[model samples]
Target: MHRSVLPLVRQTLGKHPAMMGVASAATGFMRQMSIKPFTPANRRREFQLKDRVESLHACRTQIFKEKGVGELPTIVVGGFVPDATEQVEFQRPLFREYGSVYYLNYPRHGFSLEMFFAQLADLIEYLNARRQRPVLFGVSFGCGLIAQFLKESANDPNLKIRGVALASPVLCTADLIRPEGEKAGGVRMLESNLKRILKSAAEGSEGVERQIERARRCFQALFETGAANRALTGRHLSIRKKIMHVIETTPADGGYQRVLALQQLDGPRDGEAVFTGPTLALLAEAEDNLLVPTSPTLSLLRDPERRRHLFPRLSFWKVTSPEPDDAVAHASLIFHHHCYNPLIRSWYHKLQAPQLFAVI
Candidate 1:
């Protein structure tokens, strides 16, 4: 009973029956005001428009500055997945490689081709406020967008880029995914079942023991692009395994922008781009050719004899690990950063040399 009704209880004890009923009514009113209802409604739909907005707000450009750095900040555009929220082995090694690092973070749903270019351009302009020329590093699908951006801004005198590095280059999306027939996607190269296989291999289970065993076999074949005998191990091999799983398992809505980008062909235009300082292409040991195996654009870029016909100066390096045990897979930079960062560090330093040294 409410303390406020205690006096009423006393008063009603000696009162008439009619007065007692009135006191009972007062007590019920006080009780209603003091206590909560038995059942409450839950209105959250999780990823309702509001939740998407809130999650997106949590993502933004993350900056890591190497102390005492001033120019040519390296900006890395990640593909598909945003750098993991926590315990992500992918990002943060770039700043340690050279100067400041500008890593793009996509709001859960705000990532798109147009958004990438806009955000990248804005970041460059913002940092250029102090008159610095930034270098661009593109990873996976990000390579396609950067290539297109370079083509579009080829003639823009105001847009001055120092150099570019493409990791596991996806110069063309149609290369990764091809339209097979009308009824459903073939059966294209990157099959959906691959995700299940990777997941099976990464997180083993007795329920799917047979499938897990099968995937472990195919998983080794995944490294066939580099060396069939290479059994990967070390620091972030397991982390890379998780990243590979996310790439294939990401929900449709989560990877909508990238999936949409897969349809159009962003082929490199023969003699078009202007900012050709020091373009470096780093292909993962296991992804040297499997990705975009028949991509004419990538083939042209990788062909040393023909690439210079387009890019006046270029450097191509296949990322390899000195220690045989390091798992230098497609997302090799994050998983085995030690293998790639020093190369990037050296490349960043070379960008300061005179034009004569720009060519390999």
Candidate 2:
């Protein structure tokens, strides 16, 4: 139910900037109520960092070492999952081949974008203390987080980021929600479909639990309907179940607050100047199930003229498969280890080469 309201609010804001103050205040109150206060106990239990200022949870995957090497390079992953234990474990084989991997988890189900950025900074500092700069790998929302971090920490001497790899990066929220012309109609259609899911669940239960149930149903319908290519339905079904589990368990208010934060994000426009490092952006050829129309970020990256100006150092790849399922193509870009792992390896090697960074 609340999911429907969020987009309406964003659409309203686009038309009338006068409501910005009221909207911001409302958003602030929601964020304050939903996000849990950070504490030392949480730090000890979740992060296992003995000397801790705040709490941050992460799943660490160590690389296999030969006898004499000092230590393998580290890869810090930023993902959308609040509890990423299983997801991180699933990527163990792929990440282990490159270096050590750490999949970070948020302290609570709901947190503001600022809080997320700060937590990522803390993780980077912790890693930098033990090692030097670590490669950053971000998927979906994680990509936006990494880009913001790069912007904020641009001039910091101690925080050197080695490289970045983004999979299905969400560069512009507006591009996804408020597309122009016919695409805008498609978004409305998708929203209408989502509302139908909520309407069907209205009779089952009442209160917060019911709302969560409806939200879960709403997402399930979106995932199912957005899946154009039936070939990937089996894999999508499995992923969708996990996603639904997260949505079901998360507090309703927190989930809504997170959505509000995403709505407010301006994406790469503000952060482009600072992101001058080796970057690999993997984009799916088909429309994302989550974002029905292709995002402006993807369009910008695809255009040679815009790409040259915005992401000069970025290596872009438009990934596609012969399979009929567009959703499968999108999912495979991230989950299909055999296809993407080698690409990551090659990029990592190129980033490490002194000559690559020496001149032009």
Maximum-TM-score candidate: 2
Model 1 TM-score (2 dp): 0.60
Off by over 4 Å in 2: 1-90, 179-185, 188-214, 221-244, 292-294, 322-328, 331-335, 355-360
Question: What's each prediction's TM-score?
Answer: 0.60, 0.64
Lowest-sum lDDT 10-residue window in model 2: 59-68
Flag clash pairs in model 2: 229-325
lDDT of 1 by residue, 1-360 (tens): 697986565555435655544544564454334322211022122223333343434323333333224455666676655342212233444443445555554444334444445556666666666666677877876677778878766766656677888777776654554333322423423533233433443454442444433434443455334434433332233344444554444333334434445435366666655346678777667663345445555577667776786567777777887877654777555446777877766776677655435444
Q: Pick the candidate with the highest lDDT.
A: 1
Worst-scoring 10-residue span by lDDT in model 1: 38-47
Query: Residue-wise lDDT of candidate 2 within 23-79, one digit each (tens)?
Result: 545644543343233221122222334234332221121112111121224444434
